[model samples]
Target: MDTYQTMDVAVVGGGPAGLSAAVTLARSLRSVAVVDAGEPRNAPAEGAHNVLGQDGIAPRDLLAAGRREAQEYGALFHDDRAVTARRHDGGFELVLAGGTVVHARRLLLATGLVDELPDVPGVRELWGSSVLHCAYCHGWEVRGRRIGVLGTSPMSVHQAMMFRQLSEHVTLFVHTMPDPDDDAWERLAGLGVEVVDGLVRMLRTDRGVLRTVVLADGHEFPVDAVTVTPRFVARSDLFEQLGGTLTAYPMGAFVATGPMGRTDLPGVWAAGNTSDLAAMVAAAEGAGVAAATAVNADLVAEDADTAMRARAERYAVA
Candidate 1:
């Protein structure tokens, strides 16, 4: 490990959000460091969407580009996970998995969420490729094909509707979801969506391509693509012990934060999926920018306050 060092801000996570924040802070002449575990949430997807000027770009490419850009602006990066963090000396101290420790005046938590998939077999094997979570992210590529929306909860209703817009043939599999009321049925009927009520036994794939969905009752429905609603669990254990609180949402649990990623804990901020479970790549990057701006402003205010206090002390001595 390197000698003890202090930085202006320490960013945990290296996805679009964290990298964006690091670039912003570094370009602003602030000493920023990003510690990434290298396990991105979208690593399995072929490419990312809704990102301007780089639509259809692979997630790895985008992250590499972001790292290069941030590094050019003098941002430091650590390729290890942050195991623990604690408040120290009016700032924060983070210990990495490799026993490296970092001190920073401010902290930005960009750690994203973990997607807990359904317990059905082959779903995990096909995730991010044939089995998707976001319609907007993978809709166009899989559009105009037979699509299946696996029901995990009532939220699956929205997934079905979104996919229905892309594909003419759509099926909502009530794998474990309760039966919807007449209004919900009417909506599904209006959208020309067929409802299949049965527990999914497994996803059937051939040569890594999704082919069909197998049911427990020996029925099989052919599908070109499939979508599922995953449980989003935040990666916030490192900071949660440091007075940060995780809030519950219908989708999952996330760190509670105010404007510009300000959390209830002082000297600590959170952004990206750590705070917003539903934020896409582009939205997460925008959040990173916003958080960086706010952190810079906070630092400026603190610097001014310290300078004024020193001046007052010197005047009193004179």
Candidate 2:
């Protein structure tokens, strides 16, 4: 099996967070390795929004640029998935699916998350295009269009209000979400949002283009775009292997971390969507940089301690 030399840091998932962390660590003169399976959560999206100076850039293109930047900084890239993890020699060892092993003194998880979209037909097929979530992510592109919000949870009402800000033709299909309270009804009315109460059978499409939302009762609502609230489940398989538990919330679950992305596990940290489910691209990049700085500081402290110990031993021998 191929094995890499012990590195200062090993980052899993080469998305925005992982690549950003690798760049920061390499710039600090640390030997960093990034392992990626090449499966990005946002790959299906047409463009990444709200990215400063690079707005609306294709997701794959953004990642390619990031990879080049990290490589230029002397960070190593492993185009493989980490399948297993364990403690080794007071550090961490990760076994990749490609039969490669990596050892690092510190581990940073930027594994992002998985969006479990609603089970309704066409929802998954149209995800990142006609079907959407996160108003800030794609709301602008869909402004002034026929927007429909699929109610899967209580948060659906809130989703409607957010889209209403961008367009006047907003409709909330209370498919499977809980019944809205009186206040919610009043709020919807005040905002001129239409509420449809029925089970959504499917999202009808033409040549992969979303056309309408079909209800179980045979009623169809024409919509240019449909929004949903997906359960954001963090990609924490390696974290779990390292004996870390995920923190659950109403929206989904994620890895719990303290300041600078420090997790409960020693010598291990989490950044980006792994720790913050709602983190956008810019926020994920920031988290990665923060975690890298913290990891570098930790290594510095350890090196200083080792140097002091060696000095004491030499003096005693003299």
Candidate 3:
């Protein structure tokens, strides 16, 4: 590995959160570096919605623009995965997949979460197109169409209810999820969502357009769009080197963090999907800005203390 170069902050992941943090830190005159492996969770999606002022912007375009903005401010970006990290000389050093090492005084773990999709056919192929997860993200576009909510877990009930608001014809396919309780049944009935029994054999599509959902019993329900609840898992394995931990929720697990994305470990912070699994692109960007602000304040305090100590040593020498 080459000799480690020092930086003020290392932002990992290169998604909306990472780019946002790099831009903010670089604008503040801090030496910032971003490490990303180019695998974004939303890469399959044609466009990212629900991000104000950037609604419907292609995910790649958004990241490219953010990268250019940060580069204009002298922020360095490494197109490699940070495979390992450890505490070093009162800071942290990260080893990338490309055998380069980087040391930084503070770290921003913005590596977002991964969505584990259901083990069903055609779901992966049509994902981010006709098959979706979030109603707020792609509901409006498919409104008034035949929408199907595949049952992967109990959470599918909520997904059906949310999508029902956007479409009149909504079906809840109990493919593999446990049977709904009385309350869930009541809610589904109230929302006018039809419940289908039996495991889903596969999704039927024609010419790249979703057509219907086929059950194991050969029952077919016509559908124009579908939604599934995928398990959300944050990319926090590298946090082990810093003695950081994650917290588990009903939906998934994420790194634990306090206000301003401060983690339990000193000199380390987390933001975006690393901590908030429910955060969208816009929310993740806001969290990155907040964390950057806090990090900058901390560096300012450390700088003042160093300056004072240097003055004291000079006076003693005189």
Strongest candidate by lDDT: 2
Query: What are the TM-scores, per candidate, against the unseen true structure?
Result: 0.98, 0.99, 0.97
Candidate 2 ranges beyond 4 A from true positions = none
The model with the greater lDDT, 1 or 2, is: 2
Candidate 2 pairs with clashing backbones: none
**Model 3: per-residue lDDT, tens digit, 161-202?**
999999999999998888889999998998799998889989
Stronger candidate by TM-score (1 vs 2): 2
In model 1, how large is the Cα lDDT of residue 206?
87
Candidate 2 Cα deviation (angstroms), residue 161: 0.2
Model 1: per-residue lDDT, tens digit, 78-170? 999999899888898999989999999999999999999999998899999999989889999989999999999888988899999898899
Q: Which 10 consecutive positions of candidate 3 have the poorest summed lDDT?
A: 237-246
The CA lDDT at 20 in model 2 is 94
Q: What is the C-alpha lDDT profile of model 2 across 129-191, one tens digit per residue? A: 989998998999999999999999989999999999999999999999998899999999999
Error of 1 at 59 (Å): 0.5
Q: Would you list the rank order by lDDT, best first? A: 2, 1, 3
